[model samples]
Target: MRANKYEEVWTRIMFEKIEVLSNKTAITRTEMKQGVITLVKGLNAYFNKEISAQNDAEYINKVWNNFHLCEITMNLIGSLTPKELMEIFPIEKIYDGKKYQTKDWFSAHEAVQQLAQETPISESKEVFDFLWDYHNWDLHIFTVNVIASMNNINKMEKGRGLLEQFLEEQGVRTINKMDMIDVNWEEERDGE
Candidate 1:
Protein backbone atom coordinates (compact mmCIF):
# COMPACT_ATOMS: atom_id res chain seq x y z
CA MET A 1 0.00 0.00 0.00
CA ARG A 2 2.97 2.28 -0.47
CA ALA A 3 2.03 5.26 -2.54
CA ASN A 4 4.51 6.85 -4.87
CA LYS A 5 4.25 10.39 -3.49
CA TYR A 6 2.30 12.07 -0.69
CA GLU A 7 -0.03 9.08 -0.42
CA GLU A 8 -1.56 7.99 2.89
CA VAL A 9 -2.20 4.41 3.93
CA TRP A 10 -0.68 3.91 7.36
CA THR A 11 -3.05 5.86 9.61
CA ARG A 12 -6.05 4.12 8.12
CA ILE A 13 -4.77 0.79 9.39
CA MET A 14 -4.15 2.10 12.90
CA PHE A 15 -7.62 3.61 13.19
CA GLU A 16 -9.50 0.59 11.94
CA LYS A 17 -7.49 -1.95 13.94
CA ILE A 18 -7.57 0.01 17.18
CA GLU A 19 -11.25 0.83 16.80
CA VAL A 20 -12.18 -2.80 16.36
CA LEU A 21 -10.03 -4.09 19.22
CA SER A 22 -11.08 -1.36 21.63
CA ASN A 23 -14.74 -2.06 21.00
CA LYS A 24 -14.52 -5.81 21.24
CA THR A 25 -16.01 -6.93 24.52
CA ALA A 26 -13.83 -10.01 24.71
CA ILE A 27 -10.73 -7.87 24.56
CA THR A 28 -11.52 -6.87 28.15
CA ARG A 29 -10.71 -3.54 29.75
CA THR A 30 -7.70 -5.22 31.35
CA GLU A 31 -6.32 -6.22 27.96
CA MET A 32 -6.85 -2.79 26.49
CA LYS A 33 -5.23 -1.12 29.47
CA GLN A 34 -2.20 -3.38 29.24
CA GLY A 35 -1.86 -2.89 25.51
CA VAL A 36 -1.64 0.87 25.76
CA ILE A 37 0.91 0.74 28.56
CA THR A 38 3.26 -1.56 26.69
CA LEU A 39 3.28 0.79 23.74
CA VAL A 40 4.13 3.78 25.90
CA LYS A 41 6.97 1.96 27.65
CA GLY A 42 8.56 0.57 24.51
CA LEU A 43 8.35 4.00 22.95
CA ASN A 44 9.95 5.54 26.00
CA ALA A 45 12.72 2.98 25.81
CA TYR A 46 13.36 3.83 22.18
CA PHE A 47 13.30 7.56 22.71
CA ASN A 48 15.21 7.36 25.94
CA LYS A 49 18.53 9.21 25.68
CA GLU A 50 20.28 6.10 27.02
CA ILE A 51 19.23 4.18 23.91
CA SER A 52 19.26 7.02 21.38
CA ALA A 53 22.02 9.50 20.65
CA GLN A 54 21.78 13.24 20.22
CA ASN A 55 21.69 13.66 16.50
CA ASP A 56 20.74 16.12 13.78
CA ALA A 57 17.58 16.65 11.76
CA GLU A 58 18.35 13.62 9.61
CA TYR A 59 18.18 11.37 12.65
CA ILE A 60 14.97 12.99 13.82
CA ASN A 61 13.46 12.52 10.38
CA LYS A 62 14.11 8.79 10.64
CA VAL A 63 12.92 8.27 14.22
CA TRP A 64 10.26 10.94 14.62
CA ASN A 65 7.41 9.03 12.96
CA ASN A 66 8.03 5.88 15.01
CA PHE A 67 7.86 8.15 18.01
CA HIS A 68 4.76 9.54 16.35
CA LEU A 69 3.27 6.11 15.72
CA CYS A 70 3.83 5.22 19.36
CA GLU A 71 1.95 8.35 20.34
CA ILE A 72 -0.93 7.62 17.99
CA THR A 73 -1.30 4.14 19.48
CA MET A 74 -1.37 5.72 22.92
CA ASN A 75 -4.10 8.05 21.76
CA LEU A 76 -5.87 5.18 20.09
CA ILE A 77 -5.98 3.47 23.47
CA GLY A 78 -8.08 6.41 24.64
CA SER A 79 -10.12 6.84 21.48
CA LEU A 80 -11.53 3.38 22.21
CA THR A 81 -14.07 4.92 24.52
CA PRO A 82 -15.76 8.25 25.07
CA LYS A 83 -14.63 10.43 27.92
CA GLU A 84 -14.10 14.06 28.91
CA LEU A 85 -10.75 15.77 28.73
CA MET A 86 -9.63 19.08 30.29
CA GLU A 87 -6.28 19.08 28.64
CA ILE A 88 -4.07 22.20 28.96
CA PHE A 89 -3.50 22.09 25.26
CA PRO A 90 -1.49 24.89 23.69
CA ILE A 91 -4.21 25.30 21.10
CA GLU A 92 -6.89 25.83 23.78
CA LYS A 93 -5.70 29.43 24.35
CA ILE A 94 -5.66 29.39 28.15
CA TYR A 95 -9.46 29.69 27.88
CA ASP A 96 -8.75 33.34 27.20
CA GLY A 97 -9.36 35.44 24.14
CA LYS A 98 -6.74 34.38 21.65
CA LYS A 99 -6.29 33.29 18.08
CA TYR A 100 -8.15 30.27 16.72
CA GLN A 101 -6.82 26.79 17.35
CA THR A 102 -4.71 25.21 14.66
CA LYS A 103 -6.32 22.90 12.14
CA ASP A 104 -4.46 19.96 13.74
CA TRP A 105 -5.83 20.78 17.17
CA PHE A 106 -9.35 21.23 15.89
CA SER A 107 -9.18 18.00 13.94
CA ALA A 108 -8.14 16.15 17.12
CA HIS A 109 -11.24 17.40 18.89
CA GLU A 110 -13.29 16.16 15.97
CA ALA A 111 -11.63 12.75 16.14
CA VAL A 112 -12.60 12.32 19.78
CA GLN A 113 -16.24 12.63 18.83
CA GLN A 114 -15.99 10.29 15.88
CA LEU A 115 -14.18 7.39 17.55
CA ALA A 116 -15.87 7.42 20.95
CA GLN A 117 -19.19 5.99 19.87
CA GLU A 118 -20.14 2.30 20.17
CA THR A 119 -21.47 1.96 16.65
CA PRO A 120 -20.20 3.07 13.33
CA ILE A 121 -20.17 6.83 12.87
CA SER A 122 -22.84 8.44 10.71
CA GLU A 123 -20.46 11.14 9.53
CA SER A 124 -18.50 11.15 6.30
CA LYS A 125 -15.39 8.96 6.09
CA GLU A 126 -13.72 12.01 4.65
CA VAL A 127 -14.34 13.75 7.95
CA PHE A 128 -12.70 10.91 9.90
CA ASP A 129 -9.86 10.96 7.40
CA PHE A 130 -9.52 14.70 7.74
CA LEU A 131 -9.64 14.70 11.52
CA TRP A 132 -7.04 11.93 11.74
CA ASP A 133 -4.68 13.61 9.33
CA TYR A 134 -2.65 14.75 12.34
CA HIS A 135 0.34 12.71 13.49
CA ASN A 136 -0.85 12.22 17.07
CA TRP A 137 -3.86 10.26 15.88
CA ASP A 138 -2.11 8.63 12.95
CA LEU A 139 0.18 5.59 12.73
CA HIS A 140 2.68 6.40 10.01
CA ILE A 141 4.36 2.98 10.22
CA PHE A 142 4.09 2.25 6.54
CA THR A 143 4.72 5.74 5.24
CA VAL A 144 7.81 6.11 7.38
CA ASN A 145 9.12 2.69 6.37
CA VAL A 146 8.95 3.75 2.78
CA ILE A 147 10.82 6.90 3.69
CA ALA A 148 13.44 5.13 5.84
CA SER A 149 14.03 2.55 3.14
CA MET A 150 14.52 4.92 0.24
CA ASN A 151 18.13 5.34 1.32
CA ASN A 152 18.70 1.59 1.35
CA ILE A 153 18.92 0.57 -2.27
CA ASN A 154 18.99 -3.14 -1.44
CA LYS A 155 15.97 -3.11 0.87
CA MET A 156 14.13 -1.04 -1.72
CA GLU A 157 14.94 -3.75 -4.23
CA LYS A 158 13.42 -6.31 -1.83
CA GLY A 159 10.17 -4.39 -2.36
CA ARG A 160 8.71 -4.87 1.09
CA GLY A 161 5.05 -3.91 1.03
CA LEU A 162 3.38 -1.87 3.74
CA LEU A 163 2.54 -4.78 6.05
CA GLU A 164 5.99 -6.21 5.51
CA GLN A 165 7.52 -2.90 6.35
CA PHE A 166 5.28 -2.45 9.38
CA LEU A 167 6.44 -5.81 10.75
CA GLU A 168 10.03 -4.72 10.35
CA GLU A 169 9.59 -1.52 12.37
CA GLN A 170 9.99 -1.57 16.14
CA GLY A 171 6.82 0.48 16.46
CA VAL A 172 4.72 -2.51 15.49
CA ARG A 173 7.00 -5.34 16.59
CA THR A 174 7.19 -4.34 20.26
CA ILE A 175 3.42 -4.18 20.80
CA ASN A 176 2.10 -7.12 22.82
CA LYS A 177 0.14 -8.10 25.98
CA MET A 178 3.19 -8.55 28.16
CA ASP A 179 2.86 -5.93 30.89
CA MET A 180 0.56 -3.01 31.51
CA ILE A 181 2.01 0.49 32.06
CA ASP A 182 -1.17 1.98 33.44
CA VAL A 183 -3.27 4.33 31.36
CA ASN A 184 -3.54 6.74 34.28
CA TRP A 185 -1.61 9.37 32.36
CA GLU A 186 -5.01 10.83 31.65
CA GLU A 187 -6.47 10.39 35.11
CA GLU A 188 -3.41 11.85 36.81
CA ARG A 189 -2.21 14.18 34.10
CA ASP A 190 -5.60 15.24 32.81
CA GLY A 191 -7.21 14.91 36.24
CA GLU A 192 -10.12 13.11 34.70
Candidate 2:
Protein backbone atom coordinates (compact mmCIF):
# COMPACT_ATOMS: atom_id res chain seq x y z
CA MET A 1 0.00 0.00 0.00
CA ARG A 2 1.13 3.53 -0.66
CA ALA A 3 1.88 5.96 2.16
CA ASN A 4 -0.31 8.83 3.29
CA LYS A 5 1.95 11.81 3.72
CA TYR A 6 -0.62 13.79 5.66
CA GLU A 7 -1.41 10.94 8.06
CA GLU A 8 2.28 10.19 8.56
CA VAL A 9 3.03 13.80 9.45
CA TRP A 10 0.12 13.93 11.89
CA THR A 11 1.07 10.60 13.52
CA ARG A 12 4.66 11.77 13.87
CA ILE A 13 3.51 14.83 15.76
CA MET A 14 1.37 12.74 18.08
CA PHE A 15 4.29 10.47 18.93
CA GLU A 16 6.43 13.52 19.68
CA LYS A 17 3.85 14.81 22.11
CA ILE A 18 3.70 11.43 23.84
CA GLU A 19 7.47 11.39 24.13
CA VAL A 20 7.56 14.78 25.79
CA LEU A 21 5.07 13.66 28.42
CA SER A 22 6.07 10.02 28.97
CA ASN A 23 9.79 9.75 28.23
CA LYS A 24 11.82 9.92 31.46
CA THR A 25 15.39 9.78 30.24
CA ALA A 26 17.12 13.06 31.04
CA ILE A 27 20.50 12.31 29.45
CA THR A 28 19.23 10.37 26.46
CA ARG A 29 16.24 12.54 25.60
CA THR A 30 17.35 13.53 22.13
CA GLU A 31 18.24 9.97 21.20
CA MET A 32 14.90 8.87 22.57
CA LYS A 33 13.13 11.50 20.52
CA GLN A 34 14.78 10.30 17.33
CA GLY A 35 13.97 6.71 18.21
CA VAL A 36 10.31 7.57 18.76
CA ILE A 37 10.13 9.39 15.43
CA THR A 38 11.55 6.39 13.65
CA LEU A 39 8.98 4.17 15.32
CA VAL A 40 6.22 6.51 14.24
CA LYS A 41 7.34 6.45 10.60
CA GLY A 42 7.87 2.73 10.47
CA LEU A 43 4.70 1.76 12.30
CA ASN A 44 2.66 4.04 10.14
CA ALA A 45 4.06 2.37 7.03
CA TYR A 46 3.51 -1.16 8.31
CA PHE A 47 0.02 -0.50 9.57
CA ASN A 48 -1.03 1.04 6.27
CA LYS A 49 -0.07 -2.11 4.44
CA GLU A 50 -1.37 -4.56 7.03
CA ILE A 51 -4.66 -2.80 7.60
CA SER A 52 -5.73 -3.11 3.98
CA ALA A 53 -5.42 -6.93 3.95
CA GLN A 54 -6.70 -7.98 7.36
CA ASN A 55 -7.96 -6.82 10.75
CA ASP A 56 -7.86 -9.98 12.85
CA ALA A 57 -7.79 -9.65 16.64
CA GLU A 58 -4.52 -11.55 16.82
CA TYR A 59 -2.93 -9.22 14.33
CA ILE A 60 -4.37 -6.24 16.11
CA ASN A 61 -3.16 -7.51 19.49
CA LYS A 62 0.32 -8.08 18.13
CA VAL A 63 0.39 -4.55 16.78
CA TRP A 64 -0.96 -3.18 20.01
CA ASN A 65 1.50 -5.09 22.18
CA ASN A 66 4.35 -4.14 19.92
CA PHE A 67 3.42 -0.47 20.18
CA HIS A 68 3.32 -0.70 23.97
CA LEU A 69 6.69 -2.43 24.00
CA CYS A 70 8.14 0.25 21.77
CA GLU A 71 6.98 2.99 24.10
CA ILE A 72 8.21 1.14 27.17
CA THR A 73 11.51 0.28 25.55
CA MET A 74 12.16 3.85 24.49
CA ASN A 75 11.25 5.21 27.85
CA LEU A 76 13.62 2.77 29.53
CA ILE A 77 16.22 2.62 26.75
CA GLY A 78 18.61 5.06 28.35
CA SER A 79 19.14 2.92 31.44
CA LEU A 80 18.61 -0.43 29.70
CA THR A 81 22.22 -1.59 29.40
CA PRO A 82 23.66 -3.98 26.82
CA LYS A 83 23.60 -6.81 29.31
CA GLU A 84 20.04 -6.07 30.34
CA LEU A 85 18.84 -5.99 26.73
CA MET A 86 20.39 -9.38 26.08
CA GLU A 87 18.63 -10.78 29.11
CA ILE A 88 15.16 -9.46 28.16
CA PHE A 89 15.80 -6.45 30.41
CA PRO A 90 16.48 -7.80 33.84
CA ILE A 91 15.09 -5.58 36.56
CA GLU A 92 17.44 -2.71 37.29
CA LYS A 93 19.20 -2.87 40.61
CA ILE A 94 18.74 0.49 42.29
CA TYR A 95 20.65 0.07 45.58
CA ASP A 96 23.63 -2.27 46.17
CA GLY A 97 23.35 -2.58 42.40
CA LYS A 98 25.34 -1.23 39.49
CA LYS A 99 22.63 -0.80 36.86
CA TYR A 100 20.31 2.09 37.67
CA GLN A 101 22.58 5.03 36.90
CA THR A 102 20.93 7.36 34.40
CA LYS A 103 24.07 7.27 32.25
CA ASP A 104 23.77 3.50 31.91
CA TRP A 105 20.80 4.21 29.68
CA PHE A 106 21.41 3.33 26.06
CA SER A 107 19.08 2.94 23.10
CA ALA A 108 17.21 -0.27 22.39
CA HIS A 109 17.36 0.65 18.72
CA GLU A 110 17.64 -3.00 17.77
CA ALA A 111 14.29 -3.74 19.36
CA VAL A 112 12.84 -0.93 17.30
CA GLN A 113 13.82 -2.70 14.10
CA GLN A 114 12.34 -5.96 15.32
CA LEU A 115 9.14 -4.32 16.53
CA ALA A 116 8.67 -2.38 13.30
CA GLN A 117 7.69 -5.68 11.72
CA GLU A 118 5.32 -6.27 14.56
CA THR A 119 2.15 -3.75 17.72
CA PRO A 120 -0.71 -2.62 21.18
CA ILE A 121 -1.21 0.87 22.35
CA SER A 122 -3.52 2.74 24.70
CA GLU A 123 -4.05 5.99 26.56
CA SER A 124 -1.22 8.22 27.81
CA LYS A 125 -2.20 7.57 31.41
CA GLU A 126 -2.23 3.83 30.76
CA VAL A 127 1.25 4.03 29.28
CA PHE A 128 2.50 5.90 32.31
CA ASP A 129 1.00 3.33 34.64
CA PHE A 130 2.54 0.49 32.65
CA LEU A 131 5.98 2.09 32.95
CA TRP A 132 5.54 2.65 36.66
CA ASP A 133 4.67 -1.03 37.14
CA TYR A 134 7.69 -2.13 35.15
CA HIS A 135 9.98 0.05 37.23
CA ASN A 136 8.83 -1.40 40.53
CA TRP A 137 8.89 -4.91 39.09
CA ASP A 138 12.50 -4.38 38.06
CA LEU A 139 13.47 -3.38 41.61
CA HIS A 140 11.79 -6.47 43.01
CA ILE A 141 13.49 -8.68 40.44
CA PHE A 142 16.81 -7.02 41.19
CA THR A 143 16.56 -7.90 44.86
CA VAL A 144 15.86 -11.56 44.08
CA ASN A 145 18.54 -11.75 41.43
CA VAL A 146 21.02 -10.26 43.86
CA ILE A 147 20.33 -12.99 46.35
CA ALA A 148 20.37 -15.69 43.70
CA SER A 149 23.59 -14.43 42.17
CA MET A 150 25.36 -15.01 45.45
CA ASN A 151 27.64 -18.06 45.55
CA ASN A 152 26.40 -19.23 48.91
CA ILE A 153 22.63 -19.44 49.02
CA ASN A 154 22.83 -19.97 52.78
CA LYS A 155 24.36 -16.52 53.22
CA MET A 156 21.17 -14.60 52.44
CA GLU A 157 21.99 -11.79 54.82
CA LYS A 158 25.32 -11.25 53.06
CA GLY A 159 23.48 -10.74 49.78
CA ARG A 160 21.02 -8.43 51.48
CA GLY A 161 23.87 -6.48 53.00
CA LEU A 162 25.53 -6.13 49.64
CA LEU A 163 22.29 -4.85 48.13
CA GLU A 164 21.82 -2.48 51.06
CA GLN A 165 25.33 -1.12 50.59
CA PHE A 166 24.78 -0.73 46.90
CA LEU A 167 21.50 1.08 47.45
CA GLU A 168 23.17 3.44 49.88
CA GLU A 169 26.04 4.11 47.46
CA GLN A 170 23.53 4.93 44.77
CA GLY A 171 20.98 7.54 45.72
CA VAL A 172 17.96 5.50 44.61
CA ARG A 173 15.39 5.84 47.33
CA THR A 174 13.78 2.66 48.65
CA ILE A 175 10.01 2.94 48.81
CA ASN A 176 8.55 2.16 52.18
CA LYS A 177 5.41 0.02 52.47
CA MET A 178 3.79 1.92 55.33
CA ASP A 179 4.30 5.30 53.76
CA MET A 180 2.54 4.02 50.63
CA ILE A 181 -0.87 3.36 52.13
CA ASP A 182 -3.39 6.06 51.23
CA VAL A 183 -6.92 6.69 50.06
CA ASN A 184 -6.05 6.17 46.42
CA TRP A 185 -3.24 3.63 46.73
CA GLU A 186 -5.18 1.02 44.80
CA GLU A 187 -6.70 3.52 42.39
CA GLU A 188 -3.40 5.13 41.46
CA ARG A 189 -0.50 3.33 43.06
CA ASP A 190 3.12 4.34 42.60
CA GLY A 191 5.99 2.15 43.80
CA GLU A 192 6.02 0.24 47.09
Candidate 3:
Protein backbone atom coordinates (compact mmCIF):
# COMPACT_ATOMS: atom_id res chain seq x y z
CA MET A 1 0.00 0.00 0.00
CA ARG A 2 2.87 2.33 0.55
CA ALA A 3 3.43 4.85 -2.24
CA ASN A 4 6.77 4.99 -4.00
CA LYS A 5 8.95 8.07 -4.38
CA TYR A 6 6.95 9.39 -7.31
CA GLU A 7 3.75 9.13 -5.32
CA GLU A 8 5.32 11.05 -2.51
CA VAL A 9 6.32 13.78 -4.98
CA TRP A 10 2.90 13.83 -6.53
CA THR A 11 1.24 14.02 -3.14
CA ARG A 12 3.38 16.95 -2.16
CA ILE A 13 2.78 18.70 -5.45
CA MET A 14 -0.94 18.10 -5.15
CA PHE A 15 -0.88 19.70 -1.72
CA GLU A 16 0.68 22.78 -3.26
CA LYS A 17 -2.47 23.12 -5.29
CA ILE A 18 -4.88 21.88 -2.66
CA GLU A 19 -7.23 24.48 -4.06
CA VAL A 20 -7.88 21.92 -6.77
CA LEU A 21 -9.76 19.93 -4.15
CA SER A 22 -10.76 22.74 -1.79
CA ASN A 23 -9.55 25.91 -0.16
CA LYS A 24 -6.33 25.21 1.72
CA THR A 25 -2.93 26.78 2.02
CA ALA A 26 -0.76 25.77 -0.90
CA ILE A 27 2.37 23.81 0.00
CA THR A 28 5.78 24.69 -1.33
CA ARG A 29 7.27 22.19 -3.80
CA THR A 30 10.68 22.58 -2.17
CA GLU A 31 9.35 21.47 1.17
CA MET A 32 7.48 18.60 -0.44
CA LYS A 33 10.57 17.45 -2.38
CA GLN A 34 12.68 17.41 0.76
CA GLY A 35 10.23 15.21 2.60
CA VAL A 36 9.80 12.90 -0.42
CA ILE A 37 13.53 12.39 -0.92
CA THR A 38 13.93 11.52 2.72
CA LEU A 39 11.10 9.01 2.51
CA VAL A 40 12.46 7.40 -0.69
CA LYS A 41 15.96 7.06 0.71
CA GLY A 42 14.64 5.49 3.86
CA LEU A 43 12.46 3.07 1.94
CA ASN A 44 15.31 2.15 -0.39
CA ALA A 45 17.54 1.41 2.55
CA TYR A 46 14.90 -0.70 4.20
CA PHE A 47 14.27 -2.67 1.01
CA ASN A 48 17.95 -3.25 0.40
CA LYS A 49 18.31 -4.82 3.81
CA GLU A 50 15.13 -6.93 3.69
CA ILE A 51 15.79 -8.11 0.14
CA SER A 52 19.27 -9.14 1.06
CA ALA A 53 18.04 -11.82 3.45
CA GLN A 54 15.40 -13.36 1.19
CA ASN A 55 15.17 -13.68 -2.58
CA ASP A 56 11.48 -14.34 -2.90
CA ALA A 57 10.20 -13.22 -6.33
CA GLU A 58 6.69 -12.42 -5.18
CA TYR A 59 7.90 -10.20 -2.43
CA ILE A 60 10.35 -8.58 -4.81
CA ASN A 61 7.54 -7.92 -7.28
CA LYS A 62 5.58 -6.27 -4.52
CA VAL A 63 8.53 -4.01 -3.90
CA TRP A 64 8.72 -3.24 -7.60
CA ASN A 65 4.98 -2.59 -7.63
CA ASN A 66 5.49 -0.25 -4.75
CA PHE A 67 8.17 1.57 -6.73
CA HIS A 68 6.02 1.74 -9.86
CA LEU A 69 3.21 3.13 -7.74
CA CYS A 70 5.33 6.18 -7.24
CA GLU A 71 5.95 6.59 -10.97
CA ILE A 72 2.28 6.32 -11.89
CA THR A 73 1.59 8.69 -9.06
CA MET A 74 3.35 11.51 -10.87
CA ASN A 75 0.41 11.58 -13.25
CA LEU A 76 -1.76 12.54 -10.32
CA ILE A 77 0.12 15.72 -9.60
CA GLY A 78 -0.85 18.64 -11.85
CA SER A 79 -4.50 18.43 -12.88
CA LEU A 80 -5.83 14.87 -12.71
CA THR A 81 -9.00 14.08 -10.77
CA PRO A 82 -9.06 12.15 -7.51
CA LYS A 83 -10.86 9.32 -9.28
CA GLU A 84 -8.03 9.09 -11.76
CA LEU A 85 -5.56 8.90 -8.93
CA MET A 86 -7.56 6.12 -7.35
CA GLU A 87 -7.53 4.20 -10.63
CA ILE A 88 -3.74 4.31 -10.77
CA PHE A 89 -3.37 3.48 -7.10
CA PRO A 90 -4.76 0.47 -5.24
CA ILE A 91 -5.95 2.66 -2.36
CA GLU A 92 -9.59 3.37 -1.68
CA LYS A 93 -10.66 6.73 -0.40
CA ILE A 94 -11.95 6.96 3.14
CA TYR A 95 -12.97 10.57 2.76
CA ASP A 96 -15.92 11.37 0.53
CA GLY A 97 -14.86 12.97 -2.78
CA LYS A 98 -13.12 16.05 -1.51
CA LYS A 99 -9.65 14.88 -0.59
CA TYR A 100 -7.22 11.96 -0.57
CA GLN A 101 -6.82 10.67 2.93
CA THR A 102 -3.03 11.08 3.01
CA LYS A 103 -2.83 8.50 5.73
CA ASP A 104 -4.04 5.87 3.28
CA TRP A 105 -0.97 6.29 1.11
CA PHE A 106 1.21 5.90 4.20
CA SER A 107 -0.63 2.77 5.20
CA ALA A 108 -0.17 1.33 1.71
CA HIS A 109 3.55 1.97 1.94
CA GLU A 110 3.65 0.04 5.18
CA ALA A 111 1.85 -2.87 3.52
CA VAL A 112 4.54 -3.02 0.84
CA GLN A 113 7.22 -3.03 3.46
CA GLN A 114 5.54 -5.90 5.24
CA LEU A 115 5.15 -7.87 2.01
CA ALA A 116 8.79 -7.31 1.22
CA GLN A 117 9.77 -8.65 4.59
CA GLU A 118 7.40 -11.59 4.91
CA THR A 119 7.24 -13.04 1.38
CA PRO A 120 9.75 -15.72 0.51
CA ILE A 121 12.59 -14.79 -1.84
CA SER A 122 11.83 -17.41 -4.50
CA GLU A 123 8.15 -16.78 -5.09
CA SER A 124 8.41 -13.01 -4.95
CA LYS A 125 11.58 -12.49 -6.97
CA GLU A 126 10.16 -12.46 -10.50
CA VAL A 127 7.39 -10.08 -9.54
CA PHE A 128 9.93 -7.85 -7.92
CA ASP A 129 12.05 -7.70 -11.08
CA PHE A 130 9.07 -7.05 -13.32
CA LEU A 131 7.79 -4.35 -11.04
CA TRP A 132 11.22 -2.81 -11.01
CA ASP A 133 11.27 -2.59 -14.83
CA TYR A 134 7.69 -1.39 -14.99
CA HIS A 135 8.49 1.29 -12.47
CA ASN A 136 11.41 2.49 -14.60
CA TRP A 137 9.08 3.29 -17.49
CA ASP A 138 6.70 4.88 -15.03
CA LEU A 139 9.51 7.02 -13.72
CA HIS A 140 10.48 8.14 -17.19
CA ILE A 141 6.95 9.28 -17.93
CA PHE A 142 6.61 10.88 -14.54
CA THR A 143 9.86 12.79 -14.78
CA VAL A 144 8.81 14.36 -18.07
CA ASN A 145 5.45 15.37 -16.64
CA VAL A 146 6.84 16.61 -13.35
CA ILE A 147 9.44 18.74 -15.05
CA ALA A 148 6.85 20.15 -17.39
CA SER A 149 4.54 20.90 -14.50
CA MET A 150 7.29 22.64 -12.62
CA ASN A 151 8.04 24.77 -15.66
CA ASN A 152 4.37 25.61 -16.13
CA ILE A 153 4.31 24.01 -19.54
CA ASN A 154 1.11 23.18 -21.33
CA LYS A 155 0.05 19.76 -22.59
CA MET A 156 1.64 20.23 -25.99
CA GLU A 157 4.94 21.16 -24.44
CA LYS A 158 4.71 18.27 -22.06
CA GLY A 159 4.21 15.78 -24.85
CA ARG A 160 7.08 17.13 -26.85
CA GLY A 161 9.30 17.15 -23.81
CA LEU A 162 8.36 13.60 -23.01
CA LEU A 163 9.40 12.32 -26.40
CA GLU A 164 12.60 14.29 -26.27
CA GLN A 165 13.52 13.19 -22.81
CA PHE A 166 12.68 9.59 -23.51
CA LEU A 167 14.92 9.62 -26.54
CA GLU A 168 17.70 11.25 -24.59
CA GLU A 169 17.47 8.67 -21.86
CA GLN A 170 17.59 5.87 -24.38
CA GLY A 171 20.63 7.40 -26.01
CA VAL A 172 18.81 7.90 -29.24
CA ARG A 173 18.99 11.10 -31.20
CA THR A 174 15.30 11.14 -31.85
CA ILE A 175 12.10 9.14 -31.48
CA ASN A 176 8.76 9.32 -33.19
CA LYS A 177 5.50 7.94 -31.89
CA MET A 178 3.19 9.88 -34.12
CA ASP A 179 2.53 7.08 -36.58
CA MET A 180 0.76 4.67 -34.31
CA ILE A 181 0.29 2.18 -37.09
CA ASP A 182 3.97 1.97 -37.81
CA VAL A 183 5.19 2.03 -34.23
CA ASN A 184 5.60 -1.54 -32.98
CA TRP A 185 6.55 -0.70 -29.43
CA GLU A 186 3.52 1.48 -28.86
CA GLU A 187 1.33 -1.20 -30.39
CA GLU A 188 2.84 -3.85 -28.17
CA ARG A 189 2.85 -1.76 -25.01
CA ASP A 190 -0.39 0.05 -25.80
CA GLY A 191 1.48 3.30 -25.43
CA GLU A 192 1.50 2.63 -21.73
**What's the lDDT for residue 29 in model 1?**
51
Q: Estimate each model's TM-score.
A: 0.30, 0.22, 0.20
Report the Cα lDDT for candidate 2. Answer: 0.40
Local distance difference test, candidate 1: 0.41
Model 1 Cα lDDT, one tens digit per residue, 3-22: 32212233343445556665
lDDT, residue 119, model 1: 30
The candidates, ranked best first by TM-score, are 1, 2, 3
lDDT of 3: 0.39
Q: Roughly what TM-score does model 3 have, to 2 decimal places?
A: 0.20
By lDDT, the candidates rank as 1, 2, 3
The alpha-carbon deviation from the true structure for residue 173 of candidate 1, after best TM-score superposition, in angstroms, is 34
Candidate 2: worst 10 consecutive residues by lDDT? 116-125
RMSD of each: 19.7, 19.5, 19.0
RMSD of 3: 19.0
Which stretch of 10 consecutive residues in model 3 shows the poorest summed lDDT?
76-85
Please tell me which predicted candidate would have the highest lDDT against the true structure. 1
